[model samples]
Target chain A: MDTIIQCENITHYYGQKMIYEHLNFEVARGKILGLLGKNGTGKTTIINILTGYLKPRAGICRIFGEAMERLSPAAKSRIGLLLEGHVQHAYFNIEQIEKFYSRFFPQWKREAYYELLKKLQVTPVQKISTMSCGQRSQVALGLLFAQDPDLLILDDFSMGLDPGYRRLFVEYLKEYITAENKTVFLTSHIIQDMELLIDDCIILDFGRILLHEPTSYILERFRRFRFDSDAPAFPANDILRNTERIGTHWETYSFASAAEVERELVKNGATVSRLSEDKLSLEDAFIGLTGKY
Target chain B: MYTSLFYKEWIKARKLLLLLLVVFAAAVAYTLLTTIKQFHANPVAFWEFIVENNSIRTGYMRYLPLGAGILLAIVQLTPEMHNRRLKLTLHLPLDESKILCSMSGFGLALLSGLFILSGTALLLGLRIYFCPEIVYSDFIASLPWWMGGFTAYLLTVWICLEPVWKQRIFNAIPALCCISLFYTKALPGAYVPLLPWLTVLMTAGFFFPFYSAIRFKHGVQ
Candidate 1:
């Protein structure tokens, strides 16, 4: 695979608290990779480091085979970035902002930008600050598509958007990325959106990566099992994650097959009843892997 | 590309720029009227006041440039800092230092234009009513005050660009102290001795905002 972004043993800290240690990940070309974590899991920190806004405490991140902090203007032109709030030059009207950004990119597609804006209820003279969050999102996305970069790093692109707008954003982005064969690295608080968008995912636990696999891999193998048991305690190992018992109910999530989970439950010395295997959506799998606490 | 950058700054600052121009024109007009009224009321008394008190009729407008500088910096830079929107600018497909230099250059050019227009108006008005000696001296005395305007503008950029709040406070202290230098001397030619040094100071101060921009880009806090 051709790697577009490579982070090796990256470590960072905010004050004395270690956000992550020796974290490593890679984004291959033409893949949409999602970075998911709970609050304070350093999703934004990684984005900052990758974009050269924040220096890592240790290790290095390279994009297009150059150090991120020192990316040449030519290299920078190949990447599109959308900040967490979909921030743009708010003072500029729609046409003006497009004009402003078009000057920087050699291959800017004016029609690509205006095409997306055409879907919104915005005028050419409307300043971005006056637009709603949904409108601002379209503006930001429009600018990104116009840039037509080879790689796009979007930080929480779905933030502050209503569900309809979020779906619109994902659909537009999915179509664009598919048509252009672009590499994308993104994070979003809305995991359901990620289910429809990302090809690969890296689920971040506290200070470590819990899993990094293709979306299909996780969906195919990771399962949630539930049963009724009088046992007050349940045993957990590497295969079983976050085993919980409430009243006569027992539930756990694992990548093991149904027979393997049944054997493990039987060996745990609990009388299992009503054992059943359920497939998980991305959001449920995410919660199951990370736990509910 | 730099034109586009300039266009962006122009859009953000044009309203305040027009308002500052009007404020400057008003100051010059008010000074011209005051000088004409006082000289007509009592020529000999006005001469005595000019010679003994060393007070140019334009003294009331002394702080105008400084005020203009402060207001211009606020309007030009405050929005960029709002919600940390400077990231959008820095992320442009240009060298970070070049981007910052282009931005500060645009602001400095605008300040220069405002100062030159107002200064020339005051000089012409002074020449109409006073001797060449008084006009020249008055113009010379006003140079440092105008320098204060550019200094305040650049220093304000430095403060606003600083990413850390505590560092911004630290920057403000020295900035205020430096601007205070231009307001200390009262006489027409008093600042001539300090002009070269002030020029050097202003030239060096041009880079202070770039330094703050670097720190901000590095996520210093």
Candidate 2:
């Protein structure tokens, strides 16, 4: 796969507070990478830097092998972005908004935009201010997709969307990726919804990446072990980070493969029942890694 | 591409421009009616009518360009700045220079619309009242001077709102120089420096749109 976006040692500061330091990541073409982080964790800031809305205090960021600062007209023309907030002009209707965006992007597809509006059940003639948050989001999503950009950077696309709308949005993302072979970098707090769609994930906390790995690798290596109160204390090993005792049982997470951890637990004179690996959700992994609910 | 953006700006400001034109026409009509009424009351005192009402005429003429220019500048820049659409606009395929130039061109076009309205009033007023001896040529020549000054003032007002150059020299420097040069006879000719100052002001007004366009395009505060 080709690299679409590359950031190396990228540092950004907001006044005296540090947002991100020495952040490095690469996004491959035709892959949907999920940027997971708690609120106010520099996810939007990173998106801003990638889109050239904000300049980093230190280090370099490149999109399509060209420095972000040096993004030529041709390069910018190929990038589509849906900003975090409701960003369309309030006075413009969906149709006017589409027309305005089409002027800026050379490859904008009018037919695709109208088709997406129809698919999302949004009226093109409706004013943005009169539209609900979900409707506005749908329009923004439609506009972004219409650009037909090689890389689509969506900042919290599922924000303010209801469950049904979110599901519809996810469906659109899946369909677009499958049909067009497009690359997407989406940041959302709704981890479960993105679990199936994302090929890879980046877990962020305190402006640092806790983990960057494929979803399959994470599921294969990380295991959750639970034991009853009467069970014997498990033997200490390098794989386990910390163990906590709950009311009548012990729940622990181990970085080792499930089979390896299970074998070690059984050797400690404890009858360990392996929990189904399918039970591990992205939210579980996120909490296990960040220690945040 | 630049023309398309300019056309979009025009569309956005068109309604406001229409309201401005209506206001300008009403004010002009009111002034003409009152001036004609005063003239009918006393034929010999027409020159007094001209002098006493000179300030009013000048104020009315001044208001047209100044009002329209300031209105256009505010309506053009405020929404883009507030909505953060400026960031998206700046990232477009066009150069910052081209975008700004196109916006400024739109502003100038709006200013020209005001000039046309003012010219219509002047011509209609002169034709109806038969003021052949009133030296219309002098007024015509001096109209550009005031237009230049008004355009500069409008431009300065717009630039003050931008995040660049917090000092606001563009906003204050023009007025101060104009006042000092006119009052102190600082240059070779009394009005010579004023002409360039007006030119500079008009030029700056032309650049105000570009300043906003670049600021929007570059995401510079």
Best by lDDT: 1
What would the per-residue lDDT of candidate 1 be over residues B1-221, giving only the tens digit for each residue? 89999999999989999998888898889989988998899999999989985656678778988888877788878888998889888888888889888888888899999989988888888888778888887788788889998888889999998989899999999999999998895567878889999999888888999888878767886
DockQ for candidate 2: 0.39
Cα deviation at A197, candidate 1, in Å, is 0.8
Model 2 lDDT tens row, A104-156: 77667888778777865556677787887777777877877888888888888
Check candidate 2 and list the clashing pairs.
B90-B217, B163-B221
What lDDT does candidate 1 reach at residue B219? 80
TM-score of chain B of 2: 0.73
* Quality of model 2 by C-alpha lDDT: 0.70
Find the candidate with the highest TM-score and give its number: 1
Please report, as a residue range, the 10-residue window in candidate 1 chain A with the lowest summed lDDT.
A229-238
What TM-score does candidate 2 get on C-alpha atoms?
0.83
